[model samples]
Target: MAMRASMHLVKSRTLLACAKEESEYRVRHPENSSPNARVLVLGGTGRVGGSTAIALSNLRPDLRIIVAGRNREKGASMVATLGGNSQFAEVDIENVKSLEAALKDVDLVVHAAGPFQQAERCTVLEAAIQTKTAYVDVCDDTTYSWRAKSFKDRAVAANIPAITTGGIYPGVSNVMAAELVRASRSESNGEPERLRFYYYTAGTGGAGPTILATSFLLLGEDVAAYNKGEMIKLKPYSGMLNIDFGKGIGKRDVYLLNLPEVRSVHEVLGIPTVSARFGTAPFFWNWGMEAMTSLLPAEFLRDRSKVQELVQLFDPVVRAVDRIAGERVSMRVDLECSDGRNAVGIFSHRRLSVCVGNATAAFALAVLEGSTQPGVWFPEEPEGIAIEAREVLLKRAAQGTINFVMNRPPWMVESDPKELGLGIYV
Candidate 1:
């Protein structure tokens, strides 16, 4: 009862304050794009990678982009679509020699190539540190993100700016949580008690084969969450939650997933509790996913070779379903505080593909603008994105976003909420 009482919310339109502050920041500080910056995007043939390429091209008209991948045809296609400012390079991320060759003469390297599940090593990050090039990756895997984090000292020694888990859900969502916590503590005397990340994406998120593999592989792992300053373990897809994502994307039933951000935010923000959950549209996908964990062995799902086969088998069907679902995605982050105050940050987009590209592109721009220090870090760290650059990063990332709200109560964004008498709500 005391825990519930402490979490009671005070409704205030803090979202407008957050937005106004950001707008003011943008106006006062003109963006400074890195001079003669040439970025190499590994896995540029794929959806997430290609999106990052396009976004980078859009954000920095003068910057040069090299779409690096093994597939010549696809890389050429990406380069062609990226306008004359882009070129194609045939390089494989898994091959160290090829990566080394590609890293030469590049000002920055954007590793947008992965679901990052089951990766054996932080090879790309190692290469980036060795080459002393500014680096960023859209890695979403829990183990891989930490492995990348472990290179912080090494990155500092080499004086290379590196950021991992810099994608949409893990990336922007992580930032949102950080901002909310910052606001709550600053505006009021509310100390953040719980931080819950809720995400929803429609069919494959327009992310294609790599994402499909990530989903299958994630089901094999157990969810790691925090509560009341204590660690807790829960099975993935358990602890279901229905969260409203505002208009364009409505309420979604999300389940706990072992995402890297959960742990990253918990540690970085010093929050007592942090857990992340994800849901997909058409609901049956959730059912099918739940079924997989029960029907298949964890060991089988853990195998990359076996997981790749499943990705191939379901790729066609998922593509078909994606045509129907259209890849819309939404994320809502809630922050409950000790002084009966709660706030949320919400971001919604028509298509995950475009939004993801913009998010990654924003991170790239931040790195180029010298928004980071010489070390590997997560998106929310001051050393990672620089405290001053946070507003700019969010503004750029939210370019195409349909609805992005921060530090507001649920009633402001959600069309319908559990309303009570006397202007109170659940």
Candidate 2:
């Protein structure tokens, strides 16, 4: 009992220290705070975008928010929910003119319209660059993220900051890995060796057909993971492991996926062995995904139109399952060093629909606050997220998380922490 109490006290003190440091940093860097920023959210009618708009309003009520999308009724409805400081903009991402027109006056724009998979062009990003507007995206596709990064020189030339893969798992999760790697190096916690990302969500995470489509698209791509500084390709959803997400979420089976963070973290953080795995609830979903990879042609799965058709066919059934499974989301990041030191970071939220928005909004806020430099960068890149602002970013992203811990020992954050001897845990 005393040991548990001691551990709890340590955790509390750590969190309090982080909060204090962030608070003091904010006070010292008041220029980073933008109270009257005008933000535009593309795909504002969609689940992730709508949630991001709402979360942004909740975080900064004074900021002007423009919900931009094709459907006026849906956009207007979203605007109404956001109250007076918000309005709806008729914009189509496919039309560069529409995108540029909408982004012309906004201080920042969040591109949340995605299955980012199989996307050939960064249209909105190009428009943002053309208009010199600040940009952030909830992109989770590896190719798309790299494609966005290819525009770094142009974004710098335009004097605009852009972040790709800035959503929940790839977004906050990437940041979490960065924090872990940073701490491991700074504290001399052995030579950092392996970094693994494990994610579990219930149903479609309440994000609707878009997320379902993203999942289908992922199955079409080959998984890229790093091993001992070497890049390797493996079948998607092939390697499975059971991970304990601590409180609220227990142990769940996760499988390797072609997540963007695996590459970004490996490259940016310089981790030798890095991989990312994800799993969904009801168990059968896992089986079905694996089945799809085997039964369906890779080309069919990669085709966005075909994926959308599949989503339409399965949306109702998926929605019904989602209600029963609930919208719980948990991400566990593990880092192991050569000297047998293991550090873990976990973020668990009851509603992925809401948490994803909060997470994306956190990144958007960081960009708006000038924490990011004028270029396209991944979440782990220091230029993308200033080291000093990382704590604040994580705190904001984890606003409503049921369990959010960083830079803790694996035993401390594990659901079933093993006891060795004399109060020692491993």
Candidate 3:
């Protein structure tokens, strides 16, 4: 009887899973689809995607961006908003056929979709491989970005670039640390030391379904870290710290998240210790997420419906604040050695989307300009890439919109042969 029951449960789950998959497919792909040669913005109808379109468009008008999404009208409207060089198309990530059709002929794919926390069986990286387009996704979900390594070899085999977490914490923060450590090594007999990265997305603006989805994905993965060469499962909101956001943003409280780039960076650089912490704007907001995580166990973290409800509740409020508060995303990365040596860098910007979008633009532009060494790379790898990326970011930040700043601790502020300087790259 027990065996029969187990079999029935499996069959029931399989059917339900199939049904959900079918539903996602229908939503992702709906009829008309044509890809462009220059660029493809997967979730162009959404906030980050639209901003990315604007940024890229401003940078280079000759490059065409196919604004893609399920809603043709919305995509077309966004494209129209960008003028003649931009065009709109219908394509979906959930639907594999649609994704293939959407990616056809596109040189690059920027996936800006969301709620990847519920994703189990399907992935955008798979589609990128099948489509043979260089891939970049603004996925803030740490674990999903980490798990994406499964497709790395395939990406290499296809001779296409697949980069994830192209957003604030993982994207810019990762590069920041990479640049610092690389510089330290360059100065100090070629041996890199440990690094710590802190990202605080303050002012509580621009929170969306995608961000919530990222949260859920991290929750499901139970966020992990490499400490003393052992993998330790981290509870959400467990690591808490008060970080100085610098100047106007002031001191903000942040929580330790299972941001995978920390560990991934360590792996890439062979650095022994690397950890990251994240927090939001306002003390109340920081405490609120912590409070929620404490009350809800991992089981509740896996509840999709709950995640959706939170998205609905937070999305509008966050967007409104993003527009009004001029809320900024700030990151501070510190590098240290065993003998009380440290260097710190800070990047602050008014918009999270612009911050990340610009970071992607910088790296992508570098790749286009042949500014980077060829081969698989994290933004921070290849020694000098992070330094180059930071210089680009800081230069653009000075022009306004995206603000990237670097600072060293007071003791290490002065120029010294013993310590690394700005580590700026051309």
lDDT by residue for model 2 over 205-236, one digit each (tens)? 99998999999999999999888888888888
Ranking by TM-score: 2, 1, 3
Q: Estimate each model's TM-score.
A: 0.90, 0.90, 0.79
- Report lDDT (Cα) of residue 270, candidate 2: 87
Candidates, ranked, lDDT: 2, 1, 3
What is the alpha-carbon lDDT for the whole of candidate 3?
A: 0.61
lDDT of 3 by residue, 1-426 (tens): 654343222112221122434423322331111112367887788867777777777765656788888898788789788899888888867788888887766666777776555557335678767766666666665556666756667765665655666655666677777667766766555454556677777554364566755665455446555554455566677666666766545566666677767777778767675666777765666676777777767676777787777668877776666565555777778776555556787777776756656666554443332223212345556421434345554454334534345546624323221211233100
Question: Which regions in candidate 1 have their CA more than 4 angstroms from the true location?
Answer: 1-31, 414-426
RMSD of each: 10.6, 9.8, 13.3
lDDT of 1 by residue, 1-426 (tens): 643322111001121112535434543453533444678999889999999998888877877899998899998888889888889999878888888888866878899888699999998999888877788999989999999999999987876778999989799888888888889889878688888888899988889999889989998898888877777777777666677898788778887789999889889999988888899978999998888988999899888899999999999999999999888889899888888888989899998889899999988877766566678899988778766678878888888778888999866766332222333111
As a whole number from 0 to 100, the lDDT of residue 282 in candidate 1 is 80
Comparing 1 and 3 by lDDT, which wins?
1
For all candidates, the clash counts are 0, 0, 1
Candidate 2 global CA lDDT score: 0.85
Between candidates 1 and 3, the one scoring higher on TM-score is 1
- Candidate 2 wrong stretches, greater than 4 Å: 1-32, 414-426
